[model samples]
Target chain A: MIANILDGIVLGLQFGLLAAGLTLVYGLGGVLNLAYGQMAVISAIVITLALSAGVPVLLAVALGLFVGGLAGLILDLTILRPVYRLRGEPRVLLSLLLTLGVSFIIDGFLNWRYPLETLSLRIPGEAVEILGVPMRRGSLIASAITLVTFAALFGFFRYTSLGRAVRSVIQDQEGARLVGIYPHRMLRLILVLSGVLAGLVAVTRSMVTPVDAQSGLSITVFALIVTVVGGLGNVAGALLAGIILGIVSVIAANLIGTYISLIILLAAAALTILIRPAGLLGVKE
Target chain B: MLKVKSLSAGYQGNDVVHQVDFEVGSGEAVMIIGSNGAGKTTLFRAMCGLLVPSSGQVFFEGTDISGAPAERIARLGLRFVAAERHLFPQMTVHENLLLGANPYRPDPKTMSLILDLFPRLAERRRQHAGTMSGGEQQMLAVGRALMSKPRLLVLDEPSTGLAPLLAQAAYEALGALRKQGLTVLVAEQQVPLAMSFSERGYVLENGYIKLQGTAQELAANPIVRRAYLGVT
Candidate 1:
């Protein structure tokens, strides 16, 4: 039971990071990047390719994260900014469709490039026992890394000028603009931040579970569920929701079947929608 | 410090402010007093570059700022306080004030000056803006604008929703800023209060400037008295 709980926490932290990225992008850009998972997949592929080419693991990981940030910047410069120029529901609708289209394009390209092969990061290390429960070293490291990243981000939002500008934009875009904050620049920075987060998740998760091109949709769906349950723009809430979902999924899978976990997650999402659409910590608009 | 010539602006195809012309000299306090739908808000929006005028020019300190982005215009030192207290309701009063100082880098002296100007805000600096009463929020919005240390400060309906005493206090704060040589342009519905502080007053009705003169001259005008002041 303890081991299962630990596993859930590990997975939950991963999910929380993805949801944080989703929340910021949606909050500022007013667009849900359904392609968010593909961005991760692309970073994972970059890291895998670099490792195969005999690059050191540390440099390969850095390169992969950079690939993610650059991809986010490119997408923002190309597609997302135009969609943002629109107002109201049409903007939201168009942004969704565009990201959906981009996701498909990425999937198609990756499948074409690396057909019939699954990929994973090979961070060679030995399993370690904690309180008589053996834990995979990679998973433990991933959890630690995730926690540190979240802590750093919390500080950034609280203390940095750019970070406060982001929060201000989240609070009121018009108010942000009035104070000489350019929404476009803030959007670019957020996309880059989100992309870097996706890269971290991709690198960490792929170390334990090999990923194929087809996995992006499922990952994004899980992220969407976690984000909706947490509160669309509430970062801390998303983290808590991720952990709760992770624990529940682990317990449910152990008692029933692996398929039951996904079902339970979907049900939880539906319950949130029906009962409290603003989410656990969502501010009512 | 500010000039508007033949300014025509509106929402959609309908022109709400038609061929309006005005000038505010440096360090001057001016008021545009008009009833609801008199296009005061629209005029302020145009001046701030929040809305692109269909035709006309807005010059601030001899620079044509008519079509500049609102953020760019603000960086150039003309600050606008919207009619609604547009505070970041989720953030603390300190955070809102910090953002007001965004165009210029945050400075301790400026923040201290703003807090001194409104002591109630200082007491509640850590409090979220949304939880504040309407009067407090208005003070916060104006205080946030002053954080930028603007050369020309434009306020839209600063007195519209405040209690009588709160409204008096707000104008008193504005009067203090005026004494500090900050040029102020107030668009208000309350004719008497606005005219009391302004050296010049413009009477706007249905998007046209009906009268412009020294505050005393317009305050004494027969039509101004009958229509606005409830004077027979």
Candidate 2:
């Protein structure tokens, strides 16, 4: 039981970094960006390609950040901005379809170029003792990175000018715009930020499992589940939700099996949807 | 300091206002009176760049800001306050007021000036704006807009959801703002109160201006009385 809990804590912290930003973006924008998952996929692909091309690992990571930021900009220009302009439920539907289509397109291209390969990253996945519990070194590093980034982001939104602007946009778009915050610019920046975060998570994942086209959709499913379960737009809430869900899944995989864990999480999400449409922390609008 | 000529705008792909000509000089208070659905909000929106005008000109301080984005317009010291939807609820009153000054990078002293103008707000600085009384919220809304230190302040229904006395107090504040050399264009449904405070007024019915006169003339117009004020 202890080991199962430890495993959950490890995985939860790692995944929560990606999930928190997703919650904020979805809450503010009011659109589930189906393309969000592939941001991670692209990051992994970029890092791999760069590293394979003899670039230093550090440079390759920077290259991943650049690629992720670029993808985010592209998503904003091609998907989110237009969706915002469309101005109705149609906008939500359009964004959903558009993002799904984008993810598929990216997956198709990656599959065509690379074909089927066990695309995994090799790092020292050594074991370490943490607070008297044994943990994987990769998971420990990923958790630390996630926590550090979240702490930084927390500081930013709480104290900075741009952070307030983002909060204003999230709380009230028109008011934010009225205060001279260009929504398009903020959205672009937020999209980039969200994308970069997902990219970072993918980097952590690369240190664990082999990634492929399938992982894109797979990760998206879990991320969306965690986001909604936490509460649609609450970042801290989403992190908590991610951790809870992560633990559940980890335990289920250890006990019942993988597919059953996925099933249970989906079932709970559906039940939560029926009871509280906004999730745990989202405001009822 | 503000000008709109041949300004026509509406919701996407349709025109609610047509070829409207109006101007508000520096330190002037222009009241826009209209029945509901008569295009007052649309005009205000277009002028402020919230809604893009189909065709027309908007000049501020002699700069052609006709098709600039609303945020850009706001950054240049023209701010619009949609009275009902004004306050950022979750934020503290102080935070909400500070947000009004957001378009500017950050001016420490401007905040004190705004809080000084609305001492009631200062007293309730840490309180959540959403939980504030309607009167206080409206004050916060106005106070927030002033935080930008706007030369031209555009207000939509400043009297909305206010008791007569509260509205009067709100108008008194608006009156004081004009006294301080700020240009104001107010869109109001309350004609008698509006006419009393404003120097010049425009009467709009169904998206077109039907009358332009000094407040006294508008108040005395039989048609305006019969149609708008319900005065027999």
The lDDT leader among the candidates is: 1
Per-residue CA lDDT of model 2 for A105-214, tens digit only, reads: 98888888865533365657558886678777777777777788888888887678788778788888888877788876777788888888888878777766777656
The window of 10 residues in a row where model 1 chain A has the poorest summed lDDT is A114-123
TM-score quality measure for candidate 1:
0.97
Model 2: colliding residue pairs: none
lDDT digits (tens) for residues A1-285 of candidate 1 = 998898899889988887888888887778788999998888888887887899988898899899989989988989886797798789889989999999999999999996544557656777888867788888888888889988988898888888889988888887887888998888899899889988887887876788767778887998899998998777887899899999999899999989999999999989998888988887777
Model 1: colliding residue pairs: none
Candidate 1, B66-105: lDDT as tens digits: 8788889888889899988678998899999999999667
lDDT of 1 at A122: 57
Residue A150 of model 2, lDDT score: 80
